[model samples]
Target: MQVTTATEAALLTSREIITGEELGSVPLATPGAVAAAARRAAAAAPAWAARPAAERAAILSRAAELLLERDQEAMDLLVREGGSITGKAFYEVHAGAAELRHAAALATGPDSPHGPGSEPGRETEVSRVPLGVVGVIVPWNFPLLLGMRSVAPALALGNTVLLKPDPHTPLSGGRLFAEVLADAGLPEGVLEVVHGDADAGAALVQAPDVAMVSFTGSTEVGREIGATAGRLLKRVVLELGGQNAFVVLPDADIEQAASAGSWGSFLHQGQICMAARRHLVHQDVVEAYTETLARRAAALRIGDPYRTDAQIGPVIEHGALTRIAAAVEEAVAQGARLVTGGRMQGPFFPPTVLADVTPKMAVFHKEVFGPVAAITAFADDDEAIALANTSDYGLTAAVYTSDADRGRALAPRLRCGVVHVGDQTVNHDPALPFGGIGASGNASGFGGRAALDAFTRWHTLTTSSPARAYPF
Candidate 1:
């Protein structure tokens, strides 16, 4: 692939998530510059990876402190990036700080010992060691937190990182995070930030010196990255697209499920990968649930994301609105009823609810990263499970049922990465594992211990005394 070198630097511009006005631009390392930085990181990787675990942890700890000290500045940048509403800036910053702190703890934590089944006098240990250089690509949605999830753990384990944040929105998140690491006494080139479009991301993914790649974005781009990494025989962890389902069983409280479902479908203008888009309701209560969901969705406040009272803001960009509109229109054209919303006022697409959706409609099968809820009424538990699992994408699914035994029995039957019995599908925790299955990407989870594992390789070591008799 040809790299762009037309300008000395690349400019990344984003639109305000509330006003639809341009938020100006931030300068980023161009593809050529990114390659140079990757080379620098490659040269520095071995030395960085050889540092003592506790010492490595200290840098992360300092980074976390610096993040807190500069909280306002960090949150300001995120708002300017416009990927998240102003109301959400606090959560992103807090989550990011927690990730850095957790990584520091992981670095200084005890090493893993061999399991109890080992033979006597044969000392064994399983240790996770850093990959030389990690190339990370973060999506516009939740850039600071998701991007740092890979960066913090990888660095704690002593791997150098070259991050390529989404061109639409980069700085004040991934770029800013790297800068803070520098302020915290991290050596230069250990964490580099390169910002651009797909070309820049591809350059990082294909870099021969990079030992592994961690990507969080759509499944289409993930497939390309995964394939490239496979060819190179390099380690890769991907968090891709999600078409999560919010299933309300017969025993569910319609009012409660309706409120949660509305929020789950419209949060962040429904840009989240795990945003609950599919609503599978039992036929017995579908009418009542739809009315409640529509009412709650209609009550949402929409305006500038920076406003404290704003519950729903503009979609990330005008193009996002167009895509969402097209999907909803197509579904409607195919006979799906637009129960609540299907109109866009500039970049603002109001909370939408589509009822009587069928498996054949685009709104049901395709992942719509917008505030459009596609509700399909099902006949029984078997049909609900079938409808929920029908989508090619299976990242998360939630079942709302009062009966514990039934919910437990049905949760696992859904072919998804995670299922919540009482909660909505749009839940995320920094300490738990997160990722998708099937087209949503590989089984590699994106947070907690699994995140650390994704960025590192495990080495099993065994030693025997002279008296030991065992095959090598």
Candidate 2:
């Protein structure tokens, strides 16, 4: 377990910098290379799960047309190894090439909208069956689009994967997904990449030939990988972490809720888990939305995430800028009110904006992430739904308000799972379903048909028309 390979450095300002590339302590896979890649994906998962789901949706629509013809080398390795910023690295390579063309249009067709005829002469079918190998454990914030939205719908539903990434961005998740699955031909052990970190993701989630693991990142290591994949009964897909809450509503539009809550709390600089780390506001336009969100978070443009007028970058390493400057110096030593930009400077922490934040501050109960923000000041509408349902995090929440009945009556009392009104819960759309709820972790990451029903697993063949022979 002594593999060592490091680099680190970051900066991006005081004499510009950027280094990253680390691997370090790597020894995990030699249980005969995880049993020969899980016995060659259990002997090619029953012939790629009996092929023809429109030929596995035409190889995930030619790997989303070779990932939009290699979108500027996948936004320059997601802005040089995921520190991302050139407009959030071209919105994570155009939302991972539109989540691989919406999982190749849900794998070319439809089989179960819970209908395939049953109970007449009986021939019930509710298809979707891959779940053979898939171990994916990505996360260094949008590292190659959430590891190609969890390895392109688990290789367009025929499953078989090992992925792992995030040892602080394993060279853009092992060289941009082995050069786009070798330019879309993809067959060599379906999809493999096993770099290491976090004990090689706990040896591929305690590898018992990995049946299913998905995972994204931190909800305290996704509750320890859902308690070690629920004691190895496997099948998990968590996409944890989010302190998300934006609110606003004193008939919001105070310059579009202060430019969408200062670009959803400093875009990637907040090291997003759906940024906008709690704002609340609305004591009748809390002093004009905190003076137009502290003049749009001090007119952003921090530095060097490959420019393009860098809307604040650089908080990837340096221990997330020293835990976001120690959660804004323990929320200004527990009195909160730094009102605008708390200074960090090296890993650029300026976009900060804490105003009287109190949920017994720890940047308002943890998950500050980076570009530190924390407002809080509600009056009406049930005290802005009791300060956005005081968090234990329910992921995405936002509600600027021009009164669409008070943003649909305070968006379901804001307990969160993905709410947005006038907009800025970091609006996403990898065909929808994103996740979060309580402690911000409970499996979900864009619903391209709910990620093929979380990488498949269901079987029920009941043919009863064989002249009803009853025998218990």
Candidate 3:
């Protein structure tokens, strides 16, 4: 790709999320650069694909080690650039390494060829092969983990990749991966990192050489990418938004359920797609749960993530804070009682809890991707299940109850991708397939064997022992 003149290039400025202090900047890649990246990746795909699977696996394994070796650096970047608390940032680094290791395992375990049918004098077998070049677009939240989820799998499966990180977090999301892979001795052109706005993402998706696009972001943007990729006949995997639920049963321990609810709704200031936005508590214990949750919310310390005692940090910027505050205000105006907190102090939106929130309120029905927990009272198990399934999103859901058998039976009827019987909704594991149904995603789960399936294509070969006449 031709480098643009200094004056012609755009710059993305990096800043500390809590302090608004400018850290540094990087020049944004234009759409043309994105196209060039795809072309280069296509050129590099053949040699990478021809290497033995063991070699590929080794490189990814080394990459995983190198990633953790530099965990301090990555954790700091995540906290400063991504507005992540210390604990959440630490989780992202380790989770990203786990994803790389899982991808390495997938590299050595290509699906075995299977027979299709028993036909006279004919043998048929099906094998999985890599798609040439994959376009990966990741969002700002959990940048390192989400980026690795796509980039690592695609590279390990023998496909070259062009990654586009969100404009707000180019350094941690894009450049960090490049640095780690290079340190691990990965080939230069096999993984290209591009930074820009939506135009760059579009260019990567529309590039002729890119066979597939994997995107993780909002539902609104996922729809647009899906539409465009469909028109181009390109493969796509989208993991989008959610209004997930945390259900508290009458028989559950109120204190334990309250603790889970607090973490589910306030971790990372509740920016996660799987964060519990809706709290559905049985009427019998709703009052106690609300009181406990409200007290917990009021107690959480909000400040710079660098502080050892800080539990909550700032939202991305002023705009996000404004949006969160507006949603809380609107909900309160609609008769939802502000139980404890509904205020924004500078860039920090404190952990908030709202009670008597009904489906009529926007905060109850929509995705309030902030530290606001909207609680609604349900009368019975049937009502709790109904409220949990009310949203268009079918991501992860949590059910708290003393009876394990009841939780297991209700799990299948939740209509979501994952369920935690006694835990919170904000959970992730590299070995588990994760995604959602309905508006949450296109049901394109990532991780585990799903990652393998997402990056490969199946081909069938037929052979005959003796010469056979063709029916023409």
Candidate 4:
């Protein structure tokens, strides 16, 4: 793993999220070390850029193969260290591999060298060029998938990358992915890993050699990083927090709505950034929907992450577990009804649904990244739209209705970047531009081509055709 010795002053400590056991420590990277890595990446970037797109895509394709071969071990590590269940772990493995292959396909396509032709004796040539070194900062949740979204694309598009994974999840989530790419014939310094806290992340954001910063984390952290990236006029891709709202329409299938909402709220213990923390249902069907959702949520099995049949797993750590517990307790104290699954055992928080959640409560107004979903009944379409748009975040919103046209009509009123019809709010596809607005970050507006478009700048070339006077 090329792990450096841990100094007493800067030790990188990690605890097993499932078992609460201690993991072997590694040395945290200092600002100088981060800058050094960035410098090395900047030096190798031009040579990489010179390589043909097909050749660069070959490496990314090979990386996908290598990741599939090591899938089981990777899933095990996610379960042990990252508190991911078996199904979620398997999803992560295949999803990460698929993203790499998708990026590889984008790399193999034509580079758009021909641009557009002008009739006035001139032609404009447009091309996509790398923006030097790309600094990727990923969070503990879905580290492999999020990291690959930026890394695979940058590598395929011929830009060097310096990845700094969350310090709380160094080995399984961050450093292991780096090692896998290394074994797949990636050149040294082309993809390097640094482990540390916020200091290391700030170093990457502020480094002169790093042309752009691609970050995925909380809204608070995104704001701080966005401020710096803005002040310096450096490029950045921020996928921040989401207090997403899932609307249940009157004509929606109650069972399907309940099932999708339960899964969206309880998956990964609801630590996901796009997880549906708010449930807005039409008053006409509120009683039936709440009952069905509570029943479905109660049926989920929560326990050891390593269990084959376990559907719900523990939260990432003790602090997160405690925070979730307190949030639930406070909601109950504020006159909210605990529908089901309010028990806490160690780090495990079973699927919980709260009814009668008013806007004044913390759970209703704030972003609770836990397995707690609040169900509120809206009198009409106008009231429901108002409720969903009231949140400060505009990351993702969903509307569930039997009629596709009804879903489409209602989804537009919710203020968010991505809106799904007859689907859960907790969804992601690499081809779709995944981001947010307001307190949640906004999209760079280049869809499908996520990190590649975000990390590269466009240039237009013109050539005058003055000698064409012989044309009759």
Listed in order, each prediction's TM-score against the native is 0.92, 0.37, 0.97, 0.93
Where is the poorest 10-residue window by lDDT in model 3?
Answer: 1-10
lDDT tens digits by residue: candidate 2, 273-373: 88889888877778778878898888777777765567777776777787788878878999988878887887677898888787777777688777777
Model 3 Cα lDDT, one tens digit per residue, 77-118: 898898888889999999999999999999997585575767
lDDT of 4 by residue, 71-90 (tens): 98888777877788898889
Local lDDT at 32 for model 1 = 76
Estimate the TM-score for candidate 2: 0.37
By TM-score rank, best first, the candidates go 3, 4, 1, 2
Which ten contiguous residues of candidate 2 have the minimum total lDDT? 8-17
Cα lDDT over the full model 3: 0.89
Score each candidate by Cα lDDT.
Answer: 0.83, 0.75, 0.89, 0.84
In candidate 3, stretches whose alpha carbon ends up further than 4 angstroms from where it belongs are 1-8, 110-113
Model 3 residue pairs with clashes: none
RMSD (Cα, Å) of candidate 2?
Answer: 17.4
Best by lDDT: 3
Error of 2 at 244 (Å): 8.2
lDDT of 3 at 94: 94
Off by over 4 Å in 1: 1-8, 13-25, 115-126, 460-472
For residue 243, model 3's alpha carbon misses the true position, in angstroms, by 0.6
How many Å off is the CA of 309 in candidate 4?
2.5
